[model samples]
Target: MRASVELPATLPESLRVQLGQVLPNDPNLRRPASEAAGDGVLVRLGGHADYTTVTQKAALRACLRMPSGATLLIRMATGSGKSLIFQTATRWWREVSRDSLKPVSIVLVPTISLALDHERSSQAISGLETVRALTGDHSSEERNRVLLDFRQGNVPLLFVSPEMALGSLRESLRELSLPDQHPARPNAVRGKLAAVFIDEAHIVATWGRSFRPDLQRIPGLLRSLRAIDPEIRTVLLSATVDAETRELLRTGYVDRDGRWLEVAECMPRYEFDFVEHRFTDSISRDDEVLVLADVLPRPALLYTTEVEHAERLHQGLRRRGFERVRLFTGDTEPSERRRIVDDWRDGRVDLVIATSAFGMGIDQGDVRVVVHACLPESASRYYQEIGRAGRDGRQAFAVLCAAPDDFKLASRMAVGSTLTLDVAVERWLALLEGARRTEDDDPWSGMPQYRLDLRARGRHIANPRVGERNRVWNKSLLVQLQRYGALEIASSDDDSDGWVAVPRAGNDGLWDATTCKSFLTQIFGARAAEEERAREGIQAFKSAWRVRNDCRLRMIYHIVEAGAPELSACGRCAGCRRQQVAPPHHVATGGGGESLWPDSLSPPSATRLLELTETELARPVRWLDWLRGRGVEQIVVERRLASEIAALWSKVERDAGWVISWDLVETRSFRPMNVPTALVLSEKSGTELERLWRWGKRWNDRTHQVAWWVALRGTQIGTRSLQDEGAAGIQPPAHLPSEE
Candidate 1:
């Protein structure tokens, strides 16, 4: 008799091996995790006894088995054990290694506080030692000692900020790398290094182009490091890397042939309740604090955008008889910052009023309330800041207290001051002229000798805007120029407190007066447009703040998650809580002649239906059949949706042997039916769709159905209550795709 056995193929090879040892598998352990035995190999996790959740265990299994040169993007929500990936991967590498030839991992963080937090956390893990932080705060001797220890294989894990990792850290690695070709050779730097882990990797996209250009250099650093350590793996950890940022990282870091592991879990580990307190007048700051004092428990965090706000709040709380409150900000001395942080960690401080800088590296899991005195600049920032709370998997509150004018104030602070296109062009040309003056006489030399103080360069700007006066002029522009191959950033001069800029080789034409002006105009125009959109988005956020009939947590999730699946109403936020407390007695209605568009049939809901339609479109053979297979019933029960599915099915026909097409256009009077049409839109058809939608929904009652289609393309959307889309009446465009 011939018998065959099957085994779970997804398990990591090492874990599968261990499981096989324990279960003999009933003759079912057959498939390997990878073709190569060593590829998916996992070693026993030594001395670590905590039981991991299913999500964490799956992530760990994948990490242990991940191949060299592969990039893993882990987008688990906050408090979801993001740190465990590297922690366990380090142990696995160590256990798998022979002799003292252990693996070295570099963890790049955004702040010194985060580095220190990681260092402390790693020190607590068993079988892990020499966990050091190489930050600006370290003394020269200490930094050198850490590097020496790393070179000698005494240090296994080193944490550094993005600046140090890309600059000084890369320099140290290059200087210390052995002049050996083979990674198998003993004492070779390539053989010792295993992975480069980037914590909070989303900054690469969010801040890389602007204030923190060093973040963009991470790809270059990873490329160079991987050249030395051919098997070097890149792991990016973040709680809030949006879709755009993920695409940017993928293109920047992952090679075409390499595997980019995307392990994303947006589900919340703890229940979160969001409360928005909008002030009618600016005088409500005191009232906001008083309300918070009454509502929130002790050991809460209050986040402010400015240091002045932190100070004012701290003083107000102190006067209000809150004794354990402390203040932390950029202005705080290093020693005082450390003491305040330590006090908070040791439970000595009950309430801490701090600027945005206070929460990044903090690991206090028991923080019950996180109050934002001002609106956060972006949804991502808001999510991350509030994530500091509820780490202990308990109920937590994320409170936002904003005044009527706060939206305007936040937008100004968020967008910062920008130079007009013409002003920016003038500055670019002037900088280019300065570089020209500093160039060497030697024909081969393209480097500049002049170094101007960044502040002084800003001072030279004529009639700068209010916010631009104190801002660095070329902070972002110089980086853009460098990226465009128009210039290079020569070393930063500490004595001059500025950076030297040089023209790139074979790029002198780019600095011509006309070309320079054109480049600046184009770049600055794009920047201004992006800033304007951000301002608009902030305004929308303010409007969303006034919303009281929907779930606030779900709204936030929709904002941050972007294109991910829409989550159902959490029914736990302030809005939901209020609804629970006082159920609406009756919803107002109009007369019989008045249109009563069902809440479930709104344009937003129509967009959701279109998303489902697209999913069915993926398999066109049974496209119509799948639509009729209770797709709408899964989300909501609507007879109109069922009828719409039947109508769409009638329109679908075999275009090719395996392909199908659906005709969506109807040249008739628009009815008040919640029918969604699936169309085979092309480059030209998109315009026609827009034209038809505008024509059909031209009346004031129906603003525009086409606008809904555009809004659904990006951003996570929540299910909104049915709003009036007016009774459809007008005739559609003379030519749609079907008509054409």
Candidate 2:
């Protein structure tokens, strides 16, 4: 009784008909109720208003049939209420399987971030029972208590991160039997293994391919679960995934002969808008920074290429006096992450300058923008990140800062964790039957590699020609040969060349003979095609990066169109032509001329300032150039920014004497330079504006202008109270709600 068995009734005919429009397939209806004397139970697929949408309902019904073998994908983007769906599905399972012998559900999220978010969300949706989480980071005693509760069906919803699930399951099995025997259990080694939901399922391929070595052993784990219980239901969920990912799920999980499961596909809402901009040389770099600032100022995100840049930009913005900027990166402490999440949800921070480590699953319903300081290695990642925006169904922007070097960097990462074909073959072959053997050389059990070499040496690949290419190919061949059992040649003359695997003492009758053969043929044969597809999948991602810049849009468009769009857009995208590009210095209308940071430097933004230079803009420019030991130095010596960055400074200035030109710079000469600003927002008539110098909406500085306008209607309030007379009918600070 190791496995949890859930006996759910099939979808009703009328419900099935309605669900058919949205859910995939008619669904596996329950067999007639058992011939018990008691009354039979009735169940409905999805009872939500939005489930009326085909994809939403389909995905829900499919969840009940977890362990579907194929990876299940749910692409609702960010803020689409994925937590809502999980909540509803879990509740539905509870209702449908309560009377059954086994508890019906277990949810496995990918990261602690998602776990925390899900835990709170589940409670908001249903409070029938307390929903608890089990994390390895918890104390041993705490973990034991949680596990005890889960094993006994004391908790209806058990939310856990993937790492926690793996460790917990392993520990549970260890307590039941030895490590090796764990997988051979009758069911998941527990009588309550009803359903398991794997959140962020894409990690099974992405991150799982790297640091999480245990992920590669997941298929085996799943097998063990089934061995313990045949009726265990497993669900895989991801808000964003690609066709390659979908295929990988199919071959690696579902299509395995060890498990006979079905699959259901759900579509995504709207084709995503993907674009990139250069970061260095020319105004593109400035444009990108401004774009991010503009987009983020409207409850958006600002991204940076590196930690140094993040720190620098964060400091710079604070000094420029933007009190609403929040910085988040890998370096941010967990306590800080929680705080940042709170601010975003509460609307305190207008934007977060974060690294990729930010926002895996912190749901902020009104994210209006996602700015990438660097281009992501793949569009899959791009899609996932951009999903954070428009959670409330408002328009949003996804901007990529694609400098010349940015592409190369992203390209480098594209091949980052990829394994060469040779390496792949060798690793797989090394894990073959013979190589998995115990060594006789040692008294105690251990693996033997010499026998594998001997068998490989006799193969055709052992006889190689010349050239590096051939050498690589030969290595691949050796790897391929190990697919089957080997080691016919025993070191001693008396033994046969190949040795058969020694079965466990009592496992002689483990699997039915015919059943074993069928599984073997099905798995090995199907795996061949899967391997080929994986190779191609990797190749396609690599090729997309090489596409010409002009043609790059097509690759993006192709991916967007290929994924079914289930949600309609609210326009305002480059695709939707909401804004037009302006002439140089003329500014772009799509996003107010990217100057979001020039208004006023906040305290943190000025950390680099040495007494805040007050110099003739031209002389300071020359000194700056001199320091760069580059062209800017000569200009500084000759004097250039004298009129710009110089004027913005107050005296006590470093190199020269200058006046605080808040008003002067606001009215005169200008150029794009990276600066941070503390935007004090206001409304004039119908337009929302930020006082760059304490007053007026200057469209000349794009990012700020864009940021001001977008955030206005969204119900935003400035950090400080200003004269109410500046704008007609603008709410006074008293009427303004605090920015979250």
Candidate 3:
């Protein structure tokens, strides 16, 4: 029998059906590709034995057929061949256009680590030595040679960070491909540049606000590149992008003239289960580590929100006898980063504790577990990190251990100002004014310098700790300041502790103090609003996380794809399994429990009513289970009727804080605010039904919203009639009701 066939009965019935449909006896969910088109390339990826997912095949085929000047976004699940999509697409593009030598693809990544990871993967393939990465680490001579080759159009696939691409690369490419110097290298600039791929595309949205200011230059750079290759294709890829983020990418990156295609395929084969445990103030890191040691499988990954935590956790695990564990973070030397990653992939290291820096662009199969030592900044990050496990069509676990304060801390981190925005504005204006005061400070004498003690300034503005400005915020403000054309930054080197820059007397309409102030106000104001909204969203997400009792997988799904069709519980999660093992002690029994509550009671507060109606209504099944488990005997309610109650609950909650529970309803009491509890009435005796109807009518008459009703057999849950009063209790109020 298949593993899915034995799904625990505790899972909601609807989810069980969906899981059964998708999860078959064969756990490997690869759909066989029609052996046409890119099958040749597929056979050569890693070897003929390399398994390609259906999504990869589809993406490859689409890339092959993508028209010139088109834009494509591939949002495949993490660890599900996102890099392969670009790799295969690049190869296929090269194969089809084998005739031209001019640069065909320019891949833009966010970090040097990602660029290296891509280069290594590409070099493994026989024909992909042409796949090279351009970075500052390359010697000037080597960089010149690569650029010269690229100008002469020899390099086919090149990977580069945004910094190199927008800075030195653009400068060198312009110098090499000077229209006057084209005859100097006829073989170089032959064919037009074909496509530009942006891997880890989510960064364009997430980091565009601050971390990597150069990312914001991508759109403008692409526009300039279009002048060279009018038909150049653009591809953006990421493992985690919510609908809101995807829309942002379109508006911010993909220009209006470009044709857009989206390739999204759900992750299959892997059965992901999530378990969360809370640590209290009394629990130590050692205690948390021990709990993990007991439950975690070999080849696990532990994620921390900060690098220092990663360091401490790594040491703690080793002390607890998990010596196979190692650490990977931005602090690790480049050479060490490579070694640790290679060792982890080879099973030489059983585990690695790292921050967000480690996961992207690396794929390790057979990972059995992933643990989040701290709560992630957002559900998107949480989901992507967990995706690392279960890539090999096997069952895996993702455990998140959080303390009470973790949510607020994460929220503050998510929304907190990296630097004092007002201080940054002040500094930029002061520096520019200083430059203006220098009589001989020829605007053309090249970029000026700002000997800023950012560390000191960071402390002065917000009393920020050491490394806060570098790690958290304010670096991007310089970039924005430069864009205002007042202070043009030449370079930011660690040796200087500040940045070298020039004051631009705006060749594009001279920068004056007034214009600079206007730009600063507008830019800073927008950033302030963005931070405000992000904080609100983070807080809401934290609230949702605590209240979530259904499938952890489903919660992630909803967060990622809001308004996505409801998915049933995965029956494999800790919650589902708990319900299955612990049989109820006192289920609502079938006979005369109608007049169970006293007649005289105070009306419920608006908050209590809304809580019972709206807050509890979102999950109809849970509420039904709650009713059944509680001592409400002979209860009867339809799913649709329950949903209406839930919708009404929202309105009530908005007007009044909501509350719902048997204890609260009876003790705190509300005459006109009762939320009817639901129960299955199909198998009930006629006498039982009569008793429930009599009780329900009494409850309905007293409340503004009607009480429960027997859901008729053959009637759909959401489409049941409210007029069927003869069958059960008084008809429930619809979200929009009239005199019916």
Candidate 4:
């Protein structure tokens, strides 16, 4: 018997038939859990220590072992200890790194409410007393004090929103990355810029493309930091990262040459009894919600898609004698948002009528009911909203009272926000025409950079608010172009008035009509694909509501979990109740049954092979000097060796160049620069090496400045093979030991 399944005697016939098709004869739904006691890590947590799960221990170990220039993706279920990963890691770093200046980490969240929630929760935890949330609610003096504490290393963990990360705090972050920055204490070296954690990372793919473009620019900020210190890490924490969201994150957040690792516990939430209803129109839906509000459960959340609708619904509920309900939306003032969250936590408010703005990382344990007054835009959103309930290991209810018009509204919202290719191109050209070349332009480099006015409008537009609308469209166009490898945005002003950018080396063809059209077509196609996926997700939710032949939980699991083999009909949903089966005993827990860092998988090696020297092999610094002296524009090495070499080169030459992977090169998604670059190769297979060699030859033929260095262990090949391809190779010292 697997940990995920416990058979109930005398199941209903409908559930029995459905479970027979999905579950194997002897199902093994979970990986073996960890047996090692987490006493060492827990003891360090002081008062916050509790019984740690296998998944939590594994994630913590992986986070602690994470090296510089690496990206880690954690996809656990909601209510699991995702926040503990950063909290513990920050404290552990401060304790281990014995120095006058301690390390600091920045956590970027999606909403101010989540930030405040974290700030409030940290008050009870040891070593996190100094954690602060910097949002618009703070006065200028308070914000400056927080920044001063951060600069002086008094604040170990800082919570902020993406808008502040790229805006007011941008210069301070850049300063932290500089290697020569003076330490606050005399004769003490400055502390390292530890890591950047993005909570609710799924938004980078969802909301980042449309309303909040700053999420997409986070990678650009990281690149700037890596240029100075190549070892700074990036950690993405989320409860749900589906296939599409995972792909977007890989291309946008993960470095082409750095390591990318994922830890997942993909168990669906099973503590909720689901019930859905469809009404003829808004009046009927309101009536049904009012009726359910009186009888369903206390401490509930009523979700709608629009702010006006949420406000109206809240007023209607209040008018009908529901005095404990409140409204929360994007337009809610910062002070009011804080009050609502505090009130909800303190048991002063029983219900919150909110849009998606109230979602993402708001942790409340006793929420018993979650009602949706309208349909969500996608399956992920719907799942996330409902996950707010049933988190206390108790039976909860999820009710959906939606109308027919929600389908059209959802479809329109999904497809209408994206700009057309024609509009994007028009905005791009307008911005270019209005752009002014910066004073630091190098004449011989052939890469002319300019600072464009984001407020520049197309000549045909004559609206009174053209400036604001044009600024938004301009930023959106820049984000799309950068994603497509057409341009590289260097930086932007806090006021959102202008940004500095340069066209990629090989992307000069973007100025040509045919080439530009073809390139923009690919970019627009990606957006269209996202919209289509969203529509499919909406349709799946609709099927779960309208089709009653199967379990509604099974339909949702197929959409959210996708390929997980664990499939059993949760006997508590409305469909099972209709078949005359009583709800079974189930307790919702936060952890999963999988071991973190499994034995079958090898963790990334921490050995620094570049430090080894032999009589026959030159020193790593000498090798870098030789390549730079020869004016080699690019160097190729294996992926595992690329990070060490990059760090060494950054230290020796004071120039941390880009590391392009074979995957990114193959997809043409990397930015091409005239400066020296390194390309990572695969050393495990001969077929892959040959393909890489052939691609390198073709690339050299076009670029005319290519160099290759292969890190060979014991294998020997003819030197003529290298000369034949106009490349160079390097072998390890004969006495060097192989990596374990």
lDDT of every model, 2 decimals = 0.55, 0.42, 0.54, 0.66
lDDT of 1: 0.55
State each model's C-alpha RMSD to the native.
21.1, 28.5, 20.4, 14.0
- Reference-based TM-score of each model: 0.62, 0.52, 0.61, 0.72
How does candidate 4 fare on TM-score? 0.72
The better candidate by TM-score, 2 or 3, is 3
Tens-place lDDT per residue, model 2, 288-371, is 364235323267777654676677767766766778888877677656766677677678988788766667777876676677
Of candidate 2, the 10-residue stretch with the lowest lDDT total is 33-42
Q: For residues 276-343, could you state the per-residue lDDT of candidate 1 as single tens digits? A: 66656655654555545643655688988878878888888777788888888877865576677778
List runs of model 3 lying over 4 Å from the truth. Answer: 1-54, 98-100, 111-113, 134-155, 172-192, 266-270, 416-475, 478-525, 562-565, 578-740
How big is the positional error of residue 95 in model 3, measured in Å on the Cα after superposition?
Answer: 3.2
Candidate 4 lDDT by residue in tens digits, 391-459: 665556677777888888977765547678887777766776788888775232347777888977776
* 1-740 per-residue lDDT for model 3 (tens digits): 23444544543354344345433433432222211112334544323322233345446545655667777777665666667666655655655554535435778987666777777777777667766787655778988888777666566568888767776776543333334345544544653466779998877755665555667656646655554445678888876567667776675455446467666553322356556656664145335555555445668888888787788777777777877777888788766776776787668988888888776766776777788878887776777778778776566667777776677778766764444656665655544454322222323343333443444343345544556544224446665554433454444443334544445544322245456555666656766766876776676556555663445566666666423454555665555554553322221111111111222333422111111333334344444434334322222233234223333332321111111222212322211223333333332235445444444445555652332333343322233333433344333322211215
Query: Which candidate should be chosen as best, given TM-score against the real structure?
Result: 4
Which residue pairs collide in model 1, if any?
562-715, 562-716
Q: After superposition, which runs of candidate 4 have C-alpha atoms over 4 Å from their true positions?
A: 1-36, 46-52, 180-192, 434-451, 462-465, 502-506, 511-514, 578-740
Worst 10 residues of 1 by lDDT: 30-39
Q: What C-alpha root-mean-square deviation, in Å, does candidate 4 show against the real structure?
A: 14.0
What is the full ranking by lDDT, best candidate first? Answer: 4, 1, 3, 2
